[model samples]
Target: MVSSTSEPTVVRVSQKGQATIPKGLREKFGIETPGEVFVYEDEGRIVVEPVPSPDELHGIHAEGHERGEATERLRELRDEEKRREAKRAERLRPSEDE
Candidate 1:
């Protein structure tokens, strides 16, 4: 993989001390919204990480759990369990099968 570097970009902080990360960096880091987390190095090379709020965590979980219907949920869970059991049985089977 090619190592890509970003051009120097200036970000201005408002009186409220809020700064917008550059669009290029945002796209590069997959940061689309306010709740996303990020880590960056400062001039001293100190790593700083932004923590997401409880609401953000809850929202992400909610979006993941929204599979439309309960039947779909059960079906997916059952399918996953079946795959797990098959893998376990395969592992437990004799090496002669190979």
Candidate 2:
């Protein structure tokens, strides 16, 4: 049940308990023929949210840095972690002479 300023549009549930989302609400929420939506209950009210595509989520974390810079930083961190693990393993290994 969606609330709006205008008169509330009543939707009839089919025999299978499926109700069609009103056209106006569908357009406002970007619900296409095959689009995905997240439906959950919030405070006893059902909430429907459109799921954005992966492309739409790209560069969402680019507020403080460029994508390439962030990727490079991640790579550097991974390399540093690998180096630390190798040093720890070497310290734990028995001497070859022993």
Candidate 3:
């Protein structure tokens, strides 16, 4: 399913629980077939997200790369994210001067 950003597009889901993403939405989301997308729930809604390719990430650098490299790159990205969250947390906290 596409995000709340666009007008709702009704799609018929197969009995097998698969649904075809529409062409315009696919192009908008950059969902090339023979590729994969990440599906998860957000606030009781189904969210479909494009899985970032290696070129979109640092370290691993390319597609057809090994899982280990992907894992490493993911870990690095997560760590970077944690650091950013920590900084944001600090900013949100009450300052000593307050």
Candidate 4:
């Protein structure tokens, strides 16, 4: 089910509306079993791209940032968000005397 030429290869859809991706294309795109893919239509054509796992996406934005530093920054942001939520909840609580 692999295509050797650059020309588009034809495939048949199953009764369940599933089409098997060419083996060559799947290997080139890192598509794996139990993996996720993004499917969308643009203009008149459909496109399917593999979705990278969170582990694969880690450090994708590591522009001069250390991994540990990035993780610490995320933890700080989460703690700050939790503190803000707690303050907001306190302000919205009814007074015991009321």
Candidate 5:
């Protein structure tokens, strides 16, 4: 459902448990991947959040734009982390001269 709030558009879930987040709202929240965790609260109102994951926050570029994008994206992210760690350890070692 389209929202009227000036802050951020809100989508109400129907009895079928389906809700379409407004285009503007999705863009504002930067929902590039579907697995992105969302926190919600119910107190006469509903709140949504995108929980940060180290893999998502500091990972490789997204992949599989057409199919299995989520899996591909996450895999790429993990691989990126591995590469970063290797580089970090290499830099921490003492040089041969020392």
Candidate 6:
């Protein structure tokens, strides 16, 4: 498995394809009530990640950055992450010369 936490957890999916996240897992991931979680598939595996709501992220920049500035900063951070991921993939992929 790509990642492991204790043992595998079996969650029941309803007819609507909705599955409940285990409380322990939710708490460990900082999932909060009335919040949202990022769901996606990666490397043939399903991933569910906790994402801070806009309300939660408000005023995150303790250095007194304004709301608009903070939003731009968050966008910059996301773009930075994407660039880092691209670099990692480039390094891992086989070179054409190979």
lDDT of each: 0.53, 0.64, 0.69, 0.68, 0.56, 0.68
Residue-level lDDT tens digits of model 2 in 11-79: 898999878877777786567867777666645656565565556556757687566664575456545
TM-score of model 3 (CA atoms): 0.54
Task: After the best TM-score superposition of candidate 5, give how far the Cα of residue 28 lies from its true spot, in angstroms.
Answer: 1.2
Which of the predicted structures, 3 or 5, would earn the higher lDDT when compared with the native? 3
- List clash counts for every candidate, in order: 0, 0, 0, 0, 0, 0
TM, every model: 0.36, 0.49, 0.54, 0.53, 0.37, 0.51
Model 6 residue 24 CA deviation in Å: 0.4
On TM-score, the stronger of 4 and 5 is 4
Distance from true position, residue 46, model 6, in Å?
0.9
Better of 2 and 3 by TM-score: 3
Tens-digit per-residue lDDT, 1-98, candidate 1: 43332334467989997787766555554555765554454344423233434543454445556555444643465456457546865766779846
Higher-TM-score candidate among 1 and 6?
6
lDDT (Cα, tens digit) per residue for candidate 4, span 57-93: 5775779766576557545654564575468658778
CA deviation > 4 Å runs, candidate 3: 1-5, 60-98
Candidate 6 per-residue lDDT over residues 20-59, each given as its tens digit? 9877777666788767876777567565766756776776
List residue ranges in candidate 4 displaced over 4 A.
Answer: 1-5, 60-98
Tell me model 3's lDDT, rounded to 2 decimals.
0.69
lDDT of 5 by residue, 14-91 (tens): 999978766665565555556454545534434455444556545334452455555676556555645754676587
Which is better, 1 or 3, measured by TM-score? 3
Candidate 6 worst ten-residue window by lDDT: 1-10
Q: Model 2 misses residue 23 by how many Å?
A: 1.1
Give the total clashing residue pairs for model 1.
0
Error of 3 at 31 (Å): 1.0
- In model 2, the number of clashes is 0
The per-prediction CA RMSD against the true structure, in angstroms, equals: 15.8, 20.4, 9.4, 18.5, 16.3, 7.0
